[model samples]
Target: MSDASGERQSPAPFLRLVRGNPTPEEAAALVAVLTARARAVQAARDAEAAAPAPRSAWRAPSHPAGGHPPRGAGAWRRSFHPG
Candidate 1:
């Protein structure tokens, strides 16, 4: 049937088949099962979105050249220069 704008639109084939075929009890059961499954999926997505993000373990390294040379600096310099 045509909608407000007068453009004709037909019901989907799967919807027409479902509407025409199922008994009342079967239709109710199907609706209940699908509704429960949709609620479960939405709840799982909400829980995941609310969860906190994990933090990284690494920290920023301290600078070593500001008059506080790093450990083993003397050994490293002597090894490199061989003087």
Candidate 2:
């Protein structure tokens, strides 16, 4: 039980099952099952921080080669071909 930097601590599994001393109704049923497993891990971290937040359907055109279309060599000619 020496904790304040005195070392020798390790006992927590509910203090090693109350090292043969539990009576108060088995320590109030192990503190109501460790407080319902700490309220189910804080309600799963508040439903993962209220979820929803993931969107990106490709988008990055504000000029820099906007709607592309213009590169040398008759840009794939077609204005009445058949020569």
Candidate 3:
């Protein structure tokens, strides 16, 4: 947002100490944990976004009722499609 002169306004603080006062080191530790957790969550999101989407059941290879086709010529190709 801006004022009458169009000067940018700073937003409210993202973190606030509502309870007991903590030493600088303790506060840093808390912030480190929160920041690490946030980064880990973001990394997971990034990995999921980069992953290939799952194939639909219709697009998935058809397995034999017995699980795998018997060993024989064309068995490999037969396992991938419905007869």
Candidate 4:
């Protein structure tokens, strides 16, 4: 897991395999896969942030006053402001 910067990070198994004495090729492959996955995930997150958010069906309707209505009042309007 990298921070904001795009720096290389060591995988969990890399350290374990080092202590357990893994083969050189296996270690290299593990590192490659982990780094690729990290980059892919970061790219996906960046794309999502850049993309416009989809409209939500569950989103509250905009009020004429240009702000959200008081919470929990949508179902209680009739009782409080009887017609």
Candidate 5:
């Protein structure tokens, strides 16, 4: 199938499965399974959205350099770049 722009369409997995024209009983089972899976995904998403944000233990270091304090006058050569 094509879309309004006349580009070839990609069939979703359910549509591809339906193209085989399953028996009525098989079709009913497939629908039930798909519906259950969809509900499970929605429930998981809702749970995640309702969960509390994580608490952070990290705090900015007091060093004027913005991160860890310099070890010595030549520390810049060995130290990671601080923001």
Candidate 6:
């Protein structure tokens, strides 16, 4: 693209090779490492999102909601009956 001159201009490179001039293999290696890191981070995020939430300590009953009736005759049978 060009300005009023209508001359073709080179597009700016998105990934600039800073500092040392790297060989093609080195650039490919850098890209591979970056991709792997990104994938690992995304996988961790997905696992966290899919994992079941832990029950709150306060919300759960510590022991069975009700215990045996005061140890009297036929109390065992009463235990089975709905509260």
The number of the candidate with the highest lDDT is: 3
Give the C-alpha miss distance for residue 19 in model 5, angstroms: 2.9
Candidate 3, clashing residue pairs?
Answer: none
Judged by whole-model lDDT over C-alpha atoms, candidate 4 comes out at: 0.71
lDDT of each: 0.69, 0.71, 0.84, 0.71, 0.76, 0.80
lDDT of 5: 0.76
Compared with the true structure, what per-residue lDDT tens digits does model 3 show for residues 8-70?
998887788899989999999999999999999999999999999987765557833456565
Each model's TM-score?
Answer: 0.48, 0.30, 0.60, 0.44, 0.48, 0.56
Off by over 4 Å in 6: 1-14, 63-83
TM-score of 5: 0.48
Best by TM-score: 3
Candidate 2, residues 1-83, lDDT tens digits: the string is: 88888989767675346367888898889889989999999999999999876544444454543345555678656333423
Extract clashing residue pairs from model 2.
none
1-68, model 6: which lDDT tens digit per residue?
Answer: 89788988889964667799899999999888888999999999999999999987666766444543
Residue pairs clashing, model 4 = none
Clashing pairs in 5: none
Better-scoring candidate (lDDT), 4 or 6: 6
Off by over 4 Å in 2: 1-18, 40-42, 57-83
Q: Model 1: per-residue lDDT, tens digit, 12-77? A: 643233346788798788778878999999999999999987654443245433334335758768
List, residue by residue over 1-83, the lDDT tens digit for candidate 4: 76569777766653355266778898889889989999999999999999998877556465333334445557468545545
Error (Å) of candidate 4 at residue 43 is 0.8
